[model samples]
Target: RKPGFTLGAGILPFTHADYIGEVRESGLSYLSAIKNATQYRQISDDITLNAYAAYIFGLIDLAFPDGRPVGFWFNQIKQALYLIDSGLDPQIIANVIEVQMLKEYGVEPNWRGCVIDGRADLPLDFSESYGGLLCQNHWDKDPHRLHASPRAIFYLRRFSTLDLNKVERINVKLDTKAELRRILDVIYTDMVGVTPKAKRFLDQMHQWQDRLPDDSE
Candidate 1:
């Protein structure tokens, strides 16, 4: 919904093209392409938004191979971008998207219930190695299970099923956010085995935000 030229990339026909070491801007301008794509209506070039966009793109790279689409996640990705643009809590949005990506990649944690007993009522901890939540009865399954608090598990389950379009804003405690971050880190490292460079950049940006002086002061 903004007017101005912005940086973007799109799938284009390159079948009959040859002269290429690195395609230049002149070539891009010469190609006939559609303008004012509806998908980009809500997107803007602000740095914070761009950071989240990059992170989302990085996740997409990890989730799918080049030149392919995963139909299941198409709308989920749209929802994430919209939520990112809507100024919701970005950490929570990232966490939600990561969980969805895990589901798409077939390693999603057992947020619905304990992996062993299927008891959804009991207190649970996250098991990175065992690949799901473990109640006290089955904690022995993974010697290094993550001790997730009830609050953390609650939000994890909620975020896993969250409808981003319905949320305007959210308030997450710093401790809860930290727990979510740590848990996702272990899950991604253990199961996915790759970290996107954009995630590292986003982490540094978050650290910078944390170190900044309070504006209220």
Candidate 2:
């Protein structure tokens, strides 16, 4: 198997579908083998989460040739899977990558003390057009500002520098969970200007999973 010796084998581009099949068979979650979990009502959701993990890795695999650092992406993706495998909210992982994507393309938010040179103690506000967090002073000047609660800020800070291992050990409140989703949805929409298909699928699956089993008499 010398280099440039025999055939074009392994030289062609590998499709993501191929990668998904490989991972599915590799026994990570046995997604293709198992139909449902024994006790969970949300097995479909779990399967979708596993697929989402693969999707994230696929994105990172393809992103390297476009000037992304391999090591950085590797770490980030490993952390993403860690978050997923540990049963944490995939939104955290999604926002982590989304934030980095924004920053890489010069769209990262300015969540640092109200967009710099502003009062540090002022209430935190978000301005997508301004590229970060704003204080009451700055937010009031802009008509497009959105409020960010301290709870939302707490989780956003975690996404900024999340220790994937450490985050797996923590729990979040229901109210905090709802607020985080609100803050993240706005941030992502403003930053990217479109809802990703994966996000839509996850949202739909969430709603579908919440329906009670029909008990028609």
Candidate 3:
């Protein structure tokens, strides 16, 4: 999500029902609640992954307000909604969205090779401060560089270029998902400098989900 946009939930009263009707016809409306003099209504479509839909909508609201033109992001946003609607893992979908957000800001981390020496064969570490990967030879530059494993790096590269519509479901390991989350968190902090409330809530939700007992057990 973009910096400087703070998101929260509340009701906005629209005294005029006609205005709400126009807003819905613009093809830019998200799920919202409506209340009129006569009745109350919740305006929402049938969503498969309800929690994921909420989280994704929250993230969008955190960045873009009403009537904001998401020019370049239109397609990506649609793709994310489609993927999540089809029941893709929310964590990976979140990762993909975050990566694309970084690209939109032109600050996405470099994963191609070592930022300094361009040595693809060497072990690489992701550096949020430098905004790229750093090889062991240059690890001295940032003492806090992520001791990134090859698998983490591989997925980062993959997500960086992922086309949500073209891909099928990818079941990422828990450990890999954690690593990716950590890496993205650091980069988002360093670059965007704001932790969205929606993202924080999403993280908390994941933690609670992790504590649940598996049915197979």
TM-score of each candidate structure, all chains considered together = 0.77, 0.64, 0.70
TM-score of 2: 0.64
Overall local distance difference test of candidate 1? 0.74
lDDT of 3 by residue, 29-69 (tens): 55344333311112123322444555555556656777787
* Best model per TM-score: 1
- The local distance difference test score of each candidate is 0.74, 0.58, 0.68
When superposed on Cα atoms, how far off is each prediction in RMSD?
A: 6.9, 10.1, 9.3
Worst 10 residues of 3 by lDDT: 7-16
lDDT of 2 at 103: 57
Candidate 2, superposed: residue stretches over 4 Å from native: 1-45, 58-69, 194-196, 209-217
Using TM-score as the yardstick, the better of models 1 and 2 is 1
Q: CA lDDT of 151 in candidate 2?
A: 69
Task: For each of the candidates, give the backbone clash count.
Answer: 1, 6, 0
Comparison by lDDT, 2 against 3, better one: 3
